[model samples]
Target: MRYLPLSPTEREDMLTRMGLAEIDDLFADAADKLLKAPLDLPRHKSELEVERALGALAAKNLAAGAVPFFLGAGAYKHHVPASVDHLIQRSEFLTSYTPYQPEISQGTLQVLFEFQTQVARLTGMDVANASMYDGSTAAAEAVLMAHRVTRRRNALLSGGLHPHYAETARTLSEMANDDIRILPPDPLAQEDLIAQLDDSLSCVVVQSPDVYGHLRDLRPLADACRAKGVLLVAVVTEILSLGLIESPGAQGADIVVAEGQSIGNGLNFGGPYLGLFATREKYVRQMPGRLCGQTLDSQGRRGFVLTLSTREQHIRREKATSNICTNSGLCALAFSIHLSLLGEKGLRELALVNHANAVALAEAIETIPGVKLLNQSFFNEFCVELPGPAAEFVERAAARNLLAGVPASRLSPRAGLDNLLLVASSELNTDADRATLVAALREEAAR
Candidate 1:
């Protein structure tokens, strides 16, 4: 018999307390629309039959290892050391949760503290928190934090920001009823946004090596924001680019939010990615999430401790900077270990490889007919203006057993961007993968 911790009587009593007749009442509207019939699923089979069925189904998946994937926008495919996965899977880290109860979570807390340090160093910021859900959420959270810091609710988001990241921020701001001004996506939106800045605006968020993979010159933008007393938010989805380019903090970015996945974390089907958020030391208290600090025990043994507990959900219901709970422990740990393994020199070298691979791919793809490389300046990813609808072209390529790039229309429907395609390449993509994508594009062009 299947085991349920809640007995039927107890469940009924709990529902009674809530003044609900049955659990279906929780989904009353859904219940009203319930399929008047059972789902037409396949018939159940014996355990052995099920195992055989699943094995055959699993055989159909074209895994990253089996294919030369050139897919990346936020998440990327990079070389992860065997040791990184080995250490994260260990029972000790997997079993742990929030390090609030430090006595029992020292190992977990120390690792988080180290991870924070890694993020701060990589982003060139004064401090960083344990971690956030992923780059997208982190980018969203950073917007709210900016609003609080400036005591202004209006935010100006550049069109060049990652479409997913921008859309997420807009949604979160809507829920918060925060006024956000979204700019048009300009692959070459080099206009100084600071000129439009004013006392009413809370912050200006811009991404370098933006969604199109173009490297932005943020120093001027940062300077413009400073003139208006506006906060400059720098968002980086491609963290590896930092190793190869100038750090945003070195410019005038008051807050630097980036996805930490490209460094040590793997793209596990969109996520479980790490968010890297950092800023000047003065803003540490106002920063979101838990922060780990170095402290000394009675005997002066160096130890890590939770620095600020003002976060909502941490204290009485009324007081909290945020309601976010439980950091991405395993993902952050993987990120920390990988960065540790690839220290400064190694990270820069790996970045060089990624950029080189991308450069090589771009050079080769440009040679194909009916294909125009749109962005003159980009890193790992760039837009390709195809001769036909990008979605159809991508599907055609997939039919040839090749997974083409993402269609622009997918980001924003009929964006009149149907012909634009965003493709990416990392160190893992071989020369053969480039040839395949180009060949498929040529065939589609002919058709």
Candidate 2:
């Protein structure tokens, strides 16, 4: 019943063998606060008692589905079919890891292959990897891949790119001594990114239905990047937008990265979400994450194998395309399953419903006093400028049992955007829910 088999004498022996006096010596490099602070948790509890304690804590927070929820920035709330959950829980998928040997792991390998194909087709790219950690990490990886392909170290981040994604790319680029230029947030999608392009820039990242929900016209920026021999990295936080709009790849994006959570995954307080990464065939070797490729066995039987796995485990640390350890296998499976269920026609119809719902909500908000719409063209999400600080309005709404949208200041606290709120609508949203949000905002503004 002893988790730590070593007794006091055995532990002392090991420490002595390592020329250390105690186990704390092993954590000498850790921060003083980390080594000193004890967790504020009960020292002991029975299984049922622990469950009851945790349940009490959980009940203190409001569930998303219980309120008229309208939150969306990178994460969204879409109805996932019960069948998708049931299928992913199948023992073959729920517990599978990356198949080391493809011969015996055909089921998992094929699932990955299908996932890759689905992503590639959806993104209008020639190739796609299994998946990335999430949309932000994928954006960071795409920037690195551009650097590798172009032999340049400078990246340009659109003002509309999600702050988290921009921060992720900036941190990684800074570590490599690469230059990353980020424009100020442009809620109207009017930034002249083409004029900002230069020969030194390795890639240009633009997000459509950007953080503010203003759909960006990436064609001109893509042309500019191509003219300057710079790669164009297009980011999509709401992957469902692809169903309604022209694929970014079709508009000249060299690399496309997206958060596939909108398709099948739920916002489990942010993650675990699927990161969809795809690119043109010419840059496949430079792409990060594992790639699943279809092949034939000796018997001419169809098979799936890892075509490329440029990670620290498979290649020299310095030569690996990405230091990323693994992919979001289970999340990817869920995404694939959801998209499969919604064939091309079903996806388009779903997208149309999302757009219509958002438009109706925007119209309702616009009619209210002291509120202004910021997007002229958007898919399912948009921004609204309020009379007072968004944080204050959100708190007031929550008190009335309505979960309002994210405040722009929450993402960029110092950007002087406290009056801005980012809101989204999906198929899950109903007319009544939209009405509740508008009435709450109107009352908050009047106060």
Q: Which candidate gets the maximum lDDT versus the true structure?
A: 2
Q: At residue 274, give the lDDT of candidate 2.
A: 87
lDDT of 1 at 441: 75
Q: lDDT tens string, model 1, 233-281?
A: 8999989888888898898788999988886677667878888889999
Clashing pairs for predicted structure model 1, backbone only: 311-320, 312-320, 312-321
**lDDT for model 1, on a 0 to 1 scale?**
0.83
Q: What's the TM-score of each model vs. the native? A: 0.87, 0.90
lDDT of 1 at 398: 70
lDDT (Cα, 0-100) at 374 in candidate 1: 81
List where candidate 1 sits over 4 angstroms from the true fold: 1-60, 190-192
In every candidate, how many clashes are there?
3, 0
Give the worst 10-residue stretch by lDDT in candidate 2: 307-316
lDDT of 2: 0.90
TM-score of 1: 0.87
